[model samples]
Target chain A: MAIRQLSVFLENKKGSLSEITNLLAEAKVDLRSMCIAETSNYGIVRIIANDPAKALEILIASGFAAQIRPVTAFAVPDQPGGLAQVLEILEENGINIEYMYALVTTIADKAYAVMRTDDEEKTEAVLAKNNIELLDEKNV
Target chain B: MENRKYYQPEFETMPVEDIKKLQSEKLIKQVKHVYENVPFYRARMDEKGVKPEDIKGIEDLYKLPFVEKSDLRDNYPYGMLAKPLADCVRIQSTSGTTGKRVIAYYTQYDIDLWEDCCARALVAAGADKEDVVQVSYGYGLFTGGPGLNGGSHKVGCLTLPMSSGNTERQLQFMTDLKATVLCCTPSYAAYLGESLKEMGYTPETIPLKAGIFGAEPWTSENRRQLEATLGIKAYDIYGLTEISGPGVSFECAEQGGMHINEDHFVAEIINPETGEPLPEGEKGELVFTCLDKEAFPMLRYRTRDICVLSRKPCSCGRTFIRMSKPMGRSDDMMIIRGVNVFPSQIEAVLLKEGYTPNYQIKLSRVNNNDTFDVFVELPPEQFDDSVKSISAKEASLRDAMRNMLGIGPAIHLVPPKTITRSEGKAVRIIDERKLHD
Candidate 1:
């Protein structure tokens, strides 16, 4: 099973990243994994944290103009076709992936893949029924 | 009406010999007073092996070393005061935005001379006793406020001492007072003009006849916008706090250029690099010699403003030498990637493209190399199309900047009114390279 994630809009300017991190730091939220999808002007800061609800609240209070959307994360074998299997399942479930990127992992032979899809719940069911493992704090 | 006639003469029409003789007399007295009273001046003159008696006329001014803004800063609060502290009736200082504030001392006589200069500038700009003048320059340590206040009073205009910052109140006062002439920075004038339009007030109903703008170097594009928006003739008033605020010179109704107050202050263009004087009509550094100032007499003070001087008689019948609008400061020139770039050059490019000149340049170092980025505020009309228009505008700006600055800068177009709008001085450049840990 995969856990839901959120994508936040970040302005690409000085002190922007520090401002967001400071907000999350104040809220006592630890980011498990994060990545920045950046263009020249603005960026989308996606993060998987210990507490998503609290992170969303802190972001809103800081006037970040962010949005909470469900993204699927899958833990797979760090071998060939590990990510391929997960994408094939999502394709069969009629789900379109806008973008996806990998997260850092502690285990040498295992990695987690984060993906943005059309339907989070449907994608979560497909991954669970297909025996695809979703990585959480305990798994890491 | 009788008082108005006393103030209406064109000083430029006077013979060059008469102006030269007047300047020489004033220069001799000013040099003697500074040498005797101001310790800094006395010490500097002694070190140079020059005496007050050596400076017989304006031609001998080269004997003095040029004073600069840093010299004023070194003196700080009271070291530069030529008169005793008790005799000093007024004091003004620079904003100290870059470093320590430079405080200027003025006695009753100094104040009177400053007002006279401003009054001369106003008279040259076609202001008369019947004109209701609204002064919107920032007051206090900043010279723009009090300088114009005294000048307008001397010109016998019904002066409105509305110092800058509050635009809404300024508009209300302008409309209510039916002010015929306004004094302020050119940028503020444009902002006020835009605000008035937003409030549904047409330019014709504003009752403004003319404006005198200065304190910062503004381009002709800004002047045209201010003139069009206010539906009034906009004139450039040139002066620095070091020289005595916005009354050192002014443009006439013909709008050719600003005429220096040759009788009170001697203007010279000098090669900035070589420190040698340049001929008229050539662009170089401006150095002013205060001929009549008593309390704080500055001799050949080097003003880093890069401009050209022309001695041709203006259409307004003033024979005073005219200085073009300054292009950039010699000190403020930014050398990026071996190419010299100026903020004013970027300003010209943006204004030509129909964008607000409200932008900030951020210079940083990445990968051990210099990087430049421009953050600009998008206009309201382009807000809805921000995502699409900003990208296109960014591409165009990158190309334009490359052509002008010789380097392509990453342009970031933000939403409307996002950048801070300063009521006083606008901060347009940020060099992050200096902030390295």
Candidate 2:
């Protein structure tokens, strides 16, 4: 299944990530997984949160450029090569992942990985065919 | 192209006394024209307790309050117009890299005189009707392309309005049309030169006889490289969008300094600190007063180009006063930790340290403190993306920059070609502090 994620544009200055996280915490929004892609001047912080709309509102109100994007989230075994198994499915299916991040659920004891791809529908179908367990907003 | 030294010989070779006489008459008239028409200029003049009568000749240029870049921004679109909107035929503007683009209006007459200046520049570069001129300066709100395009036609050259980019097509035209004169920024000219060699064409294979480069500050060593690479006489043309672009002054065969068009625009050098006019041959901020323009005539506008001026006689027989190549701009100086820094100084350090000149400076304000960082591109052979390797390179560059800039800068070692290439003006600085605006 697909989960909503927040992508915030932040300048490459100290405490920028902290500012975003602190803003989210102030809004009582719990983050699922986070990853950052950066260049020389600025960075894009991609984060899956429990309430994507609330998190995005907090960031935008704080003068940050933030947007919500649907990302595929799936759970794998909490062991080595857990990512390789899911990645092999996409690779064999000719699905390209733009970026991805992973985190292990404390209660479920299963590692969860969030992925953004060019073809979201294809990525979802391929992951399902590989017998991967997907997570929706409720599961997250 | 057959050699044609001067376009309008009378304007080009006018005696110093005659040039001054023409300038004085135009200055007195322009001052009155701006005061009566432009409310912005009138208010500024009124605020300074000065009148049009106070300005008689170029000597009184110092009495007028200086017009800074902010004035144009404050007055946005048509606030600075000195002519009726109906009479204005064209407009050119700045790139608005830092802030809003400053739009400059031009009447038909204004465009004519501007083109005349460019034609004169073309003649100085040995362009004639027999030549094929390929103008590569980016055309649009930018003044480089249109200014030279008109000039090329006025000179009766077979004009190729190629504008900028599309290197493959540019080379195709250059070879097919046998363009004898090239007009573009020095950076793009260098890229063309590099591409030509990569395509297996040597200087001997190229038919270019001359090139006119401007818009961005370039080094003397760069001029030499362009000359050697393209097998052409590289000339420097100076102008700003505020005061009729790309033909305000031009280098002739002498190549010592650019000869300012004293008839169309009056030139003055003033101490950046005190705004007092300096004697000829003293380095200071270059200022200008539009004498011939009918629309958007700026009076005593501070150009911020750091350079010197002289009236030395030239082998080209033009008696117009010449301006030394601009060293850097006073406005371009960055204040970091109470220390003044210029990006050119950093560029000099990078060049000396055997690195490509591709670099970017990012200034940000975090936690109420200014953070200055220089992102330099590493050549392919030396590029190491690892933390330890990049940190080491950054350390070395920081030390060198600290020695040159007095205050140390946080250096970021980026991979080669990460910094964007500029076609019009190379954007070397990005102040993130302005992001809020």
Candidate 3:
């Protein structure tokens, strides 16, 4: 399933995260999932949003450098070893997960793990063959 | 490369009477051409209640109103072009960092004249036909690159069209091509010098012998550092996009001041506030009147660059009038706490302390009061040093700025190489006061 993610290049500063979040709120872009990878002086803030294009446009118009990336989201059963089983399958299929984070939502019965993999097509195919419930646009 | 001697010609050394006679003839012809061709000039002349016939010689130049950057902007695109767009071969413009970018057109004759002026400047800087000149000034829409390229070609030097940016590539080209003459902005020259030292390349190993640095204002302290680091004699080349590029004037090896090409463009110093002409040696706004320009002839164009003029002859043999490297632009002057401060003034102090000129000055209002902050981007080595030492440095900088500008600004020492490097025109100051208000 398609996951719209916003990748932003941010210089490491005290209020940069808050600034971006405030900007998103002002633009009315709803964020579903978020993660940040930081180095010594700068960081990349990635987020899955309802409307990736609109979020990116708003960010750029506000002078924040941002890009869009497509990732995959899989609905996992809310049970023990649910994520572990998916990881094992991906590892067996030689798929490297760059990063994985959870989406925040009101529904708590089923768990969803959004992942960015090295080979998105292969990872999706492997998950599909294994009968894993991959969340699509309809699910969100 | 052998030791090449640069020549400086004094205007007095030349028979002034003869030079004046030549200027008068050129001026008369130029005035006639401007009246016949450019409608803008024609309209302005008509509005002034003056005619081409009324301007008899060089003395009549004073009767014309001074043209300025605003004038160029008012006549944007081809409004001021004397010739048809088809006849113009090239167009260049200054970056509209402050306002609208001023576009300049060049006919084939204009380009040739420009190259001749540049060649004269290069010769004055001790460049020889055998020298391999590396032009680091940016190309395309900026006149620095092509201006130097043409001049180097005219001087019979092996010209390297290595435009600005790509320091590593520039060094490689310098070493591989054995470039001896470098042309670039003074700030970038410092950056390149630092890069060479970091790479463990000594001046003795480098083929560079002399440099012509301009496109931005720099001080003698910075020039000395550049020379010492690169093992080259650094000369200042002054010009603006409106008049021409690097060829408007150049410093001879004597390093007294830049020699304005009086043969083509007439130079004058005037009071910035009153528009009244100032005598020689008085620090005022520099203005020019193009005498030989064809496609876009400018008359009494007020450059706004504040500098002193010297009519005294130079040791080298050219009879052209010399102007001090500009102090600053009157319009760009910032007033803080009843003190006048120019960005170039702070730049000079920072450069003398072996600091990069990558700085931004932020002016803001706090509690209905004006506050000034300076963020200086330092080299990596300086960035690694103790914060205490940096604080002391800032204190001294504040003191020096106060002494020079009569105002103290909060100084922030940023990490080395934190400031962005520009390939074309560098943005020097940022005023946030207007935004907040």
Candidate 4:
């Protein structure tokens, strides 16, 4: 299943990230997972927050460029080959993964992976056909 | 209804000869008025070996020495006043740095005439007593607000004195009052149009029927955008605080160019370098000679605006000569590698290429060569997650800008809200070469 993720535009300025984190912290929004893609002049901080709608509201209200987007998140077994099987399924389906990151969850003996694929619907369909468990906002 | 089509039709539709005659008579008196009352004008005239009698009429307008902005600054607050301080009722200054602002004094009569000019603009934009005029130009020291506010009253329209910003309140009052006319800068109008769309209000749902936008340089493309967005006929009103503010000229339905109020202000195009008057239709710096101003009379004042003037009769029945939308201010023109590049030109290209007008121009001299760079915000709606995609967008914008500017510039697509804006205006130019110099 797909869950909402926050994509924030950050200018390449020192203390800008700190400013963003401080704003979210003051609002009591917990960051569950995050990854950053950087260019020479700017960066995009992708975040999966426990309360993504709240985090987005605060970030945008505080004048940070932010948006809500859908990305697929799924739980995999803790074993090393668990993540490989998911990648193998995606590679076989010819669906390209744009970016992927790990999600912080409390479920024991299980790891969560968040991914943005070129064809999100096809990726989730393939994952469901492969009998992999999908994660929604409720669980992750 | 027929009379409502033209405000002050006697003057607006005056014959060319009569208009020129009226100007000559006013100029003769104004020249004498400034010479006898203000020492600054008299000294400048004496230095040039010219007398008030030398300015016999419009033909001898060149006989008067042109007054530059520095002359006004040199004379500061009270040095340029032709009327006594006790007689003057109001003061309006240019929106410049505070250290040496060019303060313009206005008598009650001057304010009435100024409001009449603004009323003429409103009427030209199809405004009347039945209309509700919403003025969004900033008030206090800035002439846009007060100028239009008084004009709306003169036209007998229910005026909403919404002096810029407070977009939420602006929209509320606009809907509640059913404002039929909007007055503000073109950029602010665009923002309002966008906000209306965001609030799910379409052009059909809004009551605005016309807009009079001025005080900043905007392209014809921008006019088209505003017209479509607001579903109204967008008109251009041209004026400067030095010349009694927004109603020196106005656009009629034809929308070819703005008609100069020749009865009060005599306009001439002159070679900026040599001060020789250019023939009609030639692009040059605009000069004005205030014919009827009483408190702070100006004689052949150099306006530093580059534009062309034409006498082709307009269908609007106005005999006043028309001046094209100014190309750009003379001082605002940048010579990058011997090529003149104006921020307006860059802005036109940006708007044509589907970009917002919020952009910053960065210019620096690197190792004896001018390095021109333009920073444009990649609006959040157009933001992409992939860096390559954004870089491609920047490359295309750079190519388009080079095609228009005749000089290539490095274009950086930064995130939205990165550029600094004061009072809803983007600081467009940053010339670092001045720092090194």
The top-ranked prediction according to lDDT is 4
Please write out the lDDT profile of model 2 over residues B1-437, one tens digit for every residue: 44667898898899999998889899899989988998998999999999999988777778888888778878888888988999999998763323355789999999999999999999999999999999998788778899999999999999999988798999999998899999987767888898889899899899999999887666777788899999999999999888988899999989999999989998999999999899998999999989979888888888888899999888889999999888867787664432346676788789888787888988875532458988887654453222344567779999988766655889876544446668855579887652210
Clashing pairs in 4: none
Q: Give the candidate order by descending lDDT.
A: 4, 2, 3, 1
lDDT of 3 by residue, A22-67 (tens): 9889889888878887655456677877777988888777766566
Give me the overall lDDT of model 4. Answer: 0.86
TM-score of chain B of each: 0.75, 0.78, 0.75, 0.78
- Better TM-score candidate (1, 2): 2
Provide the overall lDDT of each model, using Cα atoms, as 2-decimal numbers: 0.75, 0.82, 0.77, 0.86
Q: What is the DockQ of candidate 1?
A: 0.07
Q: How many angstroms is residue A132 displaced in model 1 relative to the true structure, after the best TM-score fit?
A: 28
* Greater-DockQ candidate between 3 and 4: 4
True contacts kept of each: 0.03, 0.00, 0.00, 0.34
lDDT at position B207, candidate 1: 87
How close is chain A of candidate 3 to the true chain A, as a TM-score? 0.91
Task: Evaluate candidate 3 and give its CAPRI docking class based on DockQ.
Answer: incorrect
**Reference-based lDDT, residue B283, model 4:** 95
Q: Which candidate, 1 or 2, would have the higher DockQ against the true structure?
A: 1
The order of the candidates by DockQ, greatest first, is: 4, 1, 2, 3
lDDT of 4 by residue, B1-437 (tens): 54397889999999999998998899889988999999998998999999998988889998888888768878887888999999999998663221355689999999999999999999999999899999998887778999999999999999999997798999999988899999988767888898899999898988999999987666777788888989999999999888898899999999999999999999999999899999999999999888998998888888888999999999988888999988866677665643446677787778888888888988776433467888888777777676667789989998887766655899888878889998988888987753210
Q: Which ranges of candidate 3 are over 4 A from the true structure?
A: A1-78, A83-140, B1-13, B85-87, B97-101, B332-437
Clashing pairs in 1: B12-B319
Q: DockQ for candidate 3, please give it.
A: 0.03
